[model samples]
Target: MVDALDGRYPRNWAESWDRVGLVLGEFEHAVARVLCVVDCVPETVDQALEVGADLIVAHHPLLLKPVSSIAPDTFKGRIVHRLIRAEVALFTAHTNADVANPGVSDALAARLGLTGLRPLAPAEGAAAGGGRGAGRIGELAEPLTLAELTALAAARLPATAGGVRAAGDPGRVIRTMAVCGGAGDSFLTEAARAGVDAYLCADLRHHPAGEHLANDGPALLDAAHWATERPWLDDVAAWLRAEFPVDVVVSDLDTDPWTVHTASAHKETHP
Candidate 1:
């Protein structure tokens, strides 16, 4: 299983600061069922156990830093204990997976039916045969207003407490779009240079988004981080099913941190 994932998304492709590949469990252990998920939180760990998954192929690494201990008292510690008790292995495919051919952003673009797709910021010395990048930029089949694009994004992405938010005129036309599956504030300038009509991504901070719009950059669509990345799970699961005999399952549970949402109450009715 490790070899299969590394072959497709080599750890060498990951960024310097990223901790990809194996997180927990042993490669020598036998495996039958595998679960794919966007995050490796306590809830998802329980879900994997409930489903009888022996190996979990998570997109996010369980441990990014050098932890001092795995004592069960800690939050992440509890997750470690639970997985260890059940003898379930955890592996991550983070940024390495993002840099792959049909990457995280590629999946996002595909969901929106974007065509003529290419990397928004191509990686340095990316593998031969043209299949690596930081984010994706593409064109919609037909132009739509920013309002229409917001509606489309909400429809396409998984429902979340943080529904899609847009910056720009509701009536502004959107054709070419740049998409990144996770926090993409760093790509605003790249998207602008690409001359895309809009950029759809997650975790957009107020000041950066505001400044970009103020500078006449592309229209912005900030989606929930989890929602934007969830689509890639399908592709990952499909690949596992084809490459290995293990039964692969994709967890559909919402794991985004924000759970409750409240909008301004209708004034006329309240009054």
Candidate 2:
């Protein structure tokens, strides 16, 4: 299983700061059932066990950040302990999966029914492309207004507390667009340079988004980080099922942290 993951999304494709690949369990152990998920939290761990998954292929690394101990007192620690006790191995494919050809952004673009796909920022490497990289650049089959695009994003992406929001004129036409599956404010400038009609992505911060708009960049469609990345789970699961004999299951759990969304009664005008 590790070999399959490594071959598809080579570890070298990940960013230097990232921690990808096997996080726990023996590599030699046989993996019959696999669960593909966006996060490896306790909830998903329970789902993995319920589905009898011998291994979990997660997008976000459970131990991405620094950790002093796995004592089981902490939440992440407890999850680690739970998986280990169940003999379920954990593997992560983060940025490596992002930059692949049919990568995170590829699945996202597909949600919009985008065509003529290519990389927004092409990188040179094994997992990267025949033109794949940071984000995806493509065109809609037909043009839609900014409002229509926002509505499309909301309808297509997994429902989240914070649904799709857009920054641009509602009636503005969007033909070509760029999409990144996760926190993509980092690629704002790249999206601008790509000259797409809109940029659909997640986790756009206040300052950067405002600044990009101020500079007359493309229209923006911001969805929940998890919602944006969740589409990739289905894509990976289908691939795993096709490539291996194992039964692949995708968890449809909404793991986005924001549980409740209350709209403000008073409307504030923004120029």
User: Which digits, one per residue and each the tens of the lDDT, describe model 2 over residues 1-271?
Assistant: 7898898888999988899999998989898999999999988999999999999999998888999998989988899999999999999999999998889999999999999999988877555447669889999989999999899889989999999999989999999999999999999999999899899888999999999999999999999999989999999999899998999999999899989998899989999
lDDT of 1: 0.90
Winner by TM-score: 2
lDDT of each: 0.90, 0.92
**Which parts of model 1 are misplaced by more than 4 Å?**
126-129, 266-271
RMSD of 2: 1.7
Off by over 4 Å in 2: 125-129, 268-271
**When superposed on Cα atoms, how far off is each prediction in RMSD?**
2.8, 1.7
Error of 2 at 23 (Å): 0.9
